[model samples]
Target: MNTTHRTIVSRRARPAKEPLSQEVIVKQAFLLLREEGISGLTMRKVAKTLDTGASSLYVYVKDLQELSSYVLDYALASVKLPDSDSEEWKNNLFAALISYQQVLYKDPGVAELALTTMPLGPHSLALSEYLLKQLAASGMQAASAAWGLDLLLMHVTSSAFEHVSWAKNEKRSFTLMKEAYLSADASQFPFIHSHKNELFSGDASNNERFLWGMEVILQGILKQDQ
Candidate 1:
């Protein structure tokens, strides 16, 4: 009967668990990159997003440069090269480049990060190796294939940065540019004004511009093969 007089107490609340490893932290950083862009990415911000102390991140990532490399590698790791057996190596290369561009454009911040950092991780190396192998298979010399891969990747990253920049600061009116061109003295700038339609085509889509560059590079490679 005396046991009825006592009441049980509730257990104390448990503290939140820390991330299992740097892998989870890096994953969260990428999530932040996707949502907020590069400008919004910072150690403090990523820590907050991941619900951890910023100092803890330093143990896994030395600095923004390292973190940036990790993020770029993580993003690019998902891009699978096209089939190597197709014999249309040029087309496959072009398609792989397109896939790469799509991934970069999807996360504009990663595209910007890519411009500053060279590929140093396993994922980046794998991508370069795949492309180089594809190019060599397509009749390109090793040196030529290496250089071409470099040039193509540079163009893609830079182009993506340019597009992101333009999108962020697109206040300049295409209409105003056209009007000024139309009102200019034809004899003074005839060619410039004559191509106004083509010039002021209101921004090219990343896919279209990427495909165009791919075609140009592929053609050049074909010429070299001859």
Candidate 2:
């Protein structure tokens, strides 16, 4: 029986999956940002999600800021620039701004990153160059176009962050917070109580409010050129 028995040997276990590339690491970071707020995102957490060690991440991203820069650049890439010959510059610009807001809204924590960082990567530079070109084509002087693009980008980032804050707090649900705001003494704050309807008229109407602001800015820019 001993001579008839043959042992079957199994091959060595497959090697573990290769560590993520820098781009994959950064992409996962953005996913974590969207899943958990910015405060929840950490190098350790990112590594855990990627099934790798934190040391593996440092090979690509130097620090949190660099990771953030990557995420912002990726997010900004979603903003599509209009064709060079497209005549509706204002409309195209407006579309780009709206698209930016949509991207931020889809990933609220991204707004936080976008607010603190300046776009410096190829993706960012491309967007900036495209915007500047669009503005210049619309008859804006080079300096005005450059500065205007800066102002508009700043405004979008700030506004998106504010919206993200509101979304995070659930302040849009006027049912709970609205009552507190309305309960304030009418005599001391007549204006506050009087405007409660307008202040919290509809819950979760950020899209409309954002569009209104965008229109106002677009109008101002158009008027300046006219």
Candidate 3:
């Protein structure tokens, strides 16, 4: 009888796994989010990715909601904020908001988290501070600045979510919807039938439309101050 020979490798020779911490766990969660959107961001999957049990993750993150807030704030670190003393505060603010939208667009999971979780993480705080400072520079009162910040962030986050949802949907679905809009009865839906081209002029993912909306919101806020 012939027997196959096997060589056993020692585990000691293998590289050591990276030490687990809140930072490591959050990073792994973000990676999973990027790969599989919001559905992939689960404590079980994060622990699995880290080669640990779900119970071990609870030692660092209290629950999935906390993990989501951490991941969302971590992703917001990529947003580009302008220098404090920039002359074009309005332009810089718009640019910052645009950057914020782009950051959410990077990962749909983060966009979903932005809508659901109130992230108090360092990066999230930084974003809030930057927006408030810029709004103040624009002559907005404390109330307007606070409320406007909420509106601005909401618009950007919702826009990202809508764009991501559309991307996830079938193109045929959008085509059918567009066809329905185009085929609306002129007598019953005069505005929709007449302004069909104008209604469908721009894409949700387009920065021009996004910028226009930002401008409108800022103008409205400044107007309220006046």
Best by lDDT: 3
Could you tell me the lDDT of residue 81 within candidate 3? 91
lDDT by candidate, in order shown: 0.76, 0.77, 0.88
Which of 1 and 3 is the better model by lDDT?
3
Q: For candidate 1, what is the lDDT?
A: 0.76
Cα RMSDs of all predictions?
4.8, 4.2, 1.9
For residues 112-223, write the lDDT of model 2, one tens digit per residue.
8888876547788887777777777788667677768877887788888887787778676745777877786899889988897788554455566666666676557767
Q: Over 4 Å off in model 1, which ranges? A: 1-12, 168-185, 200-206, 221-226
The Cα error of candidate 3 at residue 117, in Å, is: 2.1
User: Predictions ranked by TM-score, top down?
Assistant: 3, 1, 2
Per-residue lDDT tens digits of candidate 3, residues 1-226?
A: 7688988899998889899999999999999999998899999899998889999988888998898989988998999998876467787788788899888877887888888888858999998998888888887799999999999999999988887778776567888999999999999999999999988787654677888888899899999999
TM-score, one value per model = 0.80, 0.76, 0.93
Better of 2 and 3 by lDDT: 3
